[model samples]
Target: MARTRPTKRQLEGLLVTALYGATWWGILSSRTPFNWVLTVASGITAECVRHSSGRDRLDCLGDAFGAIGGISGDVETGIRPYTNGIAQTKTQIISHALKQLPMGESLQQRFLDRQGVNTDWFEGFEKRCAVLVGESKDGKTFLLKWRLQRFIEQHPDGHEYYIGDIDYGRCHEGDTPNTWFDSPVGQAVFTTADDIAAKVRAIAQDIRDGHDAAVPTLIILDELVDTMEDMDRDQFEQFMRDLKTIKNRGLKAGNITFVLGLHSTTVGETGIPQWLLRGVETIWLYRAGQERANFLHLNGKNIDECPKQLARLPRSFNGLRPCIVYSDKKLSVKAIPTLDFGNIEVKYSTVELSAIQQWEQDHWTPEKELTVLQKMREREASGKTPYSNRDIMPIIGIRQNQCVRSNEVYEHAKSLILALWESSKKSEG
Candidate 1:
């Protein structure tokens, strides 16, 4: 004869004990490595047999057996290996999935298939804020840039990008304040945090109202606080407060992710309020000093084994090679090489030299062409390059001083213009 099943109360009681008590039920359900069908089936069977197994009533032997089977399957499939003290609750699992889903369709689909999270599930999700403490000029910018590119490439759907770098130069001129990111006009604008916060609020509004037309926004602030030497404590506090306000209010409106970058010491050194620190979820520490060591904690533990590679980083490598640093979770120090600007891809049409003749053909009338030639002649007589910063800055909003700071910037800009000019001449031919 087939065995009889237990009542719902008996089953619940057994399952609860098997899962190490009610507090752990959420983790058991969500983090179980066993296939969902198998997990549910096994759980049901354990419930039916728990009381009849003749095991200690408090032991819940049947449910324990089921949990063992589920955990075995989970391990084979490479699920969470160790629970440690951290709560692997269902809520946390779902929260982590959503945060990382912006990376690609595969991830999004994985989360969608779970069928556990409700439509309003993410409403209460709040991850811990992080403090990325790193040494000065230790490829922090490059790492931040890489993560950003990865996020953008993975999420083809519209995402907002806000970058704040304190090192504002003459090259960044004539940019508008708080523009939507999808258009050329918006892309043309170089922004500060103040500009980004306002834009984030607007995008968030569109998302909250179920305005299907709105796109997600990714705001990246490079060197988050500007002019460190000039900004005072109160002023810095206010700036951070404004950003916190924007973040708190914007979450309801749309998908807004902020990737803020700053030297590890800026906030502490400048006497900025620590209240801003509470708003960050994950702190990606690049290279930090001893004083700021306490701020960086990994997997809920203080990182005692800091990487020595960060000790002495050279700013400029052999004209070609990029400076690199390691910061992977497993290795504690994953190598991140510099990007090769020469090999970087450009999707939109760039101003190429070959296009010069096309420009002359399409836009420059014979009279205009002749007039330009005359002007070039006059410039040659004056010992000036007809193509100087004066001629280009107005069009690109890049200043001469900023471009000239490093030979790399100057050469790149110069090469583009030269390429365009040559291309135009060839087209004219």
Candidate 2:
């Protein structure tokens, strides 16, 4: 006869019984010298059983032990858990993440105040059009994501649209594009190259007619060159034309900003149109070859400062290369540290939570989970906070109060964050 399977209730009872037995043994054995060892062994055993069975009930038990072990570790180190995930109105994601990173100066203040520019310079817009180019693993996408998140946080009232092959396949997959277009945020997000071009043209016409709203609109195009590669020449040219028109009219009124991210090879091999390159007022150069460096006129004297800047670029401990930001008036090289969201639990709005659940349902699989776990371990080894699907799920409001590992870092980091905020105010004053 085949073995009988346990019911869900039976499994739950077994898990509770095992945990209670472990706790009792740990407590009773505390009088002995090997008490700590026994306690630790019990936790390890729980985890082993979780993996051994591959059953949901055992997995829950393992997670419970993991949470307990994690909390115990945090308490042992005196590191207070920073669970402030309630999204703040003013770039809270960046600000909260910054608290966990060690930076010479706050990035939020530097971008907003210093850099020899002011918000008024862009008129009502936060910034102008910029192209981010880098070699693979050089952190172009990371920087773009950071900038985009900051923009969304800063301009809550503004419409935000993103087209990319990142986590979401909204624009990359055929059906997702239609799904996105049907969503509440669809009005702002474009699903195709043609759609984006058309939207830009319409916005430009509205700006020309002086009928555009005062609120800013930010659009991020990731891997633009690659995206254009899939489009016909006419479509590409039309998109470029629309971009140029938008850059001239939309930028001055401070009503729109376009952020384009591309690979260095894409610019060299495919050759971005001169008009699009000229429209880029801000350039961020990551690790690229000499040929790639040649495109950047950093000094206006053909001094080849790009190569030198690229050489001096810092390598992040977490395996990301730094980049230099060059503008018309000022140039600065900075490495954006990877911020850990592990300790910071975040809550999302209803719509956002629903989207996250749907995304999880669509993408989550055993193979994917294993891959994510492996990556998380690598990140942890590099002294960075690793964000797993479990961590993100809670932040996006899919789940609640998930215990992401704490770094046990000092609480003083909060003061630095506050100081950065004060600096922004000081600059304004």
Candidate 3:
């Protein structure tokens, strides 16, 4: 009869016995190095056999070792291992094993290498408004702030402004209290939505009348949807309209550019006007869906490609993430990087409340009040009910005042003038 091949179990048993015998002999001969070599060889041999036999290497090793008792015994003393028989911790072993694995470039490094844009792209960023949309927890805010920080570093002389929902809380990683607002190098940073709207109006006016400073202005509006939600419907719509107007005017004047961060869902949701969405010249989408793609005016072909690209993204938020970038030239998938600003301390100009109040008091003169009143009356007579502060501020020549806080000053002046007008009307009646 032909000799039958040994079964897998029988072969595994024979290999285990041979390894055990070799290990015991090595220990008895005081050859510690040989014992270690034998141990490694036994593991490798078992792994190979298991691979050939269609079994898990670890499972086969466990079975073989279990049948022969563990290999951790003192072979020289011929004593089985004791000490509660606890197995070696896998955590330490795995960690050490991982250290031996080949390392690759970091996600951020890989992304920057493949960005395909030159330094000129970042330098010319002030020419257009970029809107970044992403799902919640996809690090859209982080990436937005990173771009702002990069811009500030690249263009140190550029005036920057941050408009966001973060009033006093920590918004960035490792940010302490007031860090986000305190760090940005800007003419002024507005946290409240109302204040941001007023500042935008003032900036637009500055650009419109050729009064804006020669330096480029970088405006970062983080969580635009959140800011809009804080305002009433009418106020939100007007805010979007004002943003559109600012974008158009600023682009022509070459004075201001914006980086707006909003949720992917917010773009398609009601109450967010389409004109605001259309104002974006460059789009950065992070893990977006069809709704957001449609909102970006992406056709079906591009929309179908979005999910395919997003699916290949790694789930870690540790570094740069994949984004679908749509610009005036082309639409493509790209990686956006973030920065770690935890250790960098930035200096901010502190505005004393008393100084602000005093400045307003100084600028709010009787003559200015009379000028504002005359303009409002003119607009009222022309059938414009509830004249905007924007229409009234410039006519009062607030731009000529050389006030650093021109927006706040104009607002205070407008409120005082409106109150004065109401008082005069009541007295006349």
RMSD of each: 21.6, 28.0, 15.1
What order do you get sorting by TM-score, best first?
Answer: 3, 2, 1
C-alpha lDDT of all candidate models, in order: 0.39, 0.46, 0.51
Q: Least lDDT summed over 10 consecutive residues: which range in candidate 2?
A: 84-93
- Which has the higher lDDT value, candidate number 1 or candidate number 2? 2
State every prediction's TM-score relative to the real structure.
0.34, 0.43, 0.52
RMSD of 1: 21.6
Q: Count the backbone clashes (under 3 Å) in each candidate.
A: 29, 2, 0
Off by over 4 Å in 3: 1-127, 158-162, 166-178, 181-187, 251-254, 265-270, 279-285, 289-296, 316-320, 338-345, 349-429
- lDDT, candidate 3, 1-429, per-residue tens: 011233456447436434544444444454577667776676566556656666542333323322222222122124323332222221122223223333312322343344332223333343468777765444666666666666566555544454554443544343344445366523356677666665665556456557544556667777677777777665566567667766777756655678887765344563556655554644455435323334344444665665443332332223444466655555555554444654444454433335334444334433455566677778788999645656665655555453345566656656666777898579769
Cα-lDDT of candidate 2: 0.46
Candidate 1, residues 202-253, lDDT tens digits: the string is: 3443344454323444555565545333444544444465456546654444
Superposition error at 31 for model 3 (Å)? 21
The superposed Cα distance between candidate 3 and the true structure at residue 10, in angstroms, equals 38
State how far residue 53 of model 1 sits from its true place (Å): 56
In what order do the candidates fall by lDDT, top score first?
Answer: 3, 2, 1
